[model samples]
Target chain A: MLEKKTHLNLLYDFYHSLLTDKQRQYMELYYYDDLSLGEIAEEFQVSRQAVYEHLKRAEELLHKYESQLQLVAKYEQRQQLLKRMGAILEESSPDLEELKRLVSALKNVD
Target chain B: MLEKKTHLNLLYDFYHSLLTDKQRQYMELYYYDDLSLGEIAEEFQVSRQAVYEHLKRAEELLHKYESQLQLVAKYEQRQQLLKRMGAILEESSPDLEELKRLVSALKNVD
Candidate 1:
């Protein structure tokens, strides 16, 4: 499982780096758009396997990127920090500097 | 700013779709791992501008994925829901069915 995750991370990184415009469109349709593989194939005038390949490759690419860079991990960390900050803000005694620092850190991500 | 953001989004998606293995490595060093641009350039034996360009392009690609599929948006929604659920769990009267449903929904994201 660890090996698989590492492989997936490598694939993810590669996918992030080297995607074509059309491939990206297809990926968005399948993953983010929540379209079925068959639907994506039809939209792209391709076979189901081709669509599957695209998605599989895309997943691989994302994983590749993640392994090398751990972007997802960092993003998750930042998110957790944001949540903690939110919780802190809800408290009666909020730390102003801490809030500012957290906000600045988040802004740096963009 | 909005136009810049849109452009960044497109770039981000494109980056996500098509990153090279080496590029992914550089990106992780720069973004998630928080390596400075200069440090990444030195490690890769690339110029500072090259590193900058790589980082810029990578950022663009991430934004593109976000805009096209709104994965970040969906993730945020899930996080918010989780927070709410956490809050609910802390409440005196917790809803068991709602908790189960929410957990099920989150599990589906993976």
Candidate 2:
């Protein structure tokens, strides 16, 4: 199983824009900002269960979008390829700092 | 104003997965498959106006998603950078076919 934080982070990266303002806010608080459900509920003046349910629905929507699009998967593959290419470049010229910088630029592209 | 075909193509690329089956079908037929609205309406047993409305809504949703995310913008930027890098690589070593291939691979990502 994917780690919860890792999965939520990738999903938020890919589909946060598609989510409603409330969903995005909750996700940002719960996942990226590291707030607990009770804390989020108190912040929003909602029940803890309501906050949990909202997060669950947001996750399901993100999963549905990802299943259809595979953008996150493609991003991960590109990142892996860039890392491998960086390794090759390092082997060819350990002192080529410019090449390393270029590789880093390409890898961080998203 | 952006050309209608070009705008639709980028919108489709970025948000097609978020559309309904009917909306996706209408868009694919009109933008990608080059079918006229009337022809698409006939194929789907809907009126031309209905088909046009569906395509319009799909375009609007795509634009909304894009406005929030800017995925298409980022993709175009990456392509431009890749082309620039390719030019530099070509100037450095015109006979480096492997490097050219790698540049092509990076450019066609997505």
Model 1 C-alpha lDDT per residue in residues B1-110, reported as the tens digit of each score: 37765544444433443566666777767645779988888887889999888777766667655554455565456566666656655566555456556545543442
Contacts from the true interface found in each model, as a fraction, amount to 0.00, 0.18
Q: CAPRI verdict on model 1?
A: incorrect
Compute the interface RMSD for candidate 2.
Answer: 7.3
* All models, RMSD in angstroms: 11.8, 6.2
Query: What's candidate 1's DockQ score?
Result: 0.05
Which portions of model 1 miss their true places by more than 4 Å? A1-110, B1-18, B95-110
Docking class of 2: incorrect
Model 2, residue A102: distance off in Å is 13
Q: Per the 3 Å backbone cut-off, how many clashing residue pairs does candidate 1 have?
A: 40
**Candidate No. with top DockQ:** 2
- lDDT value, candidate 2, whole model: 0.74
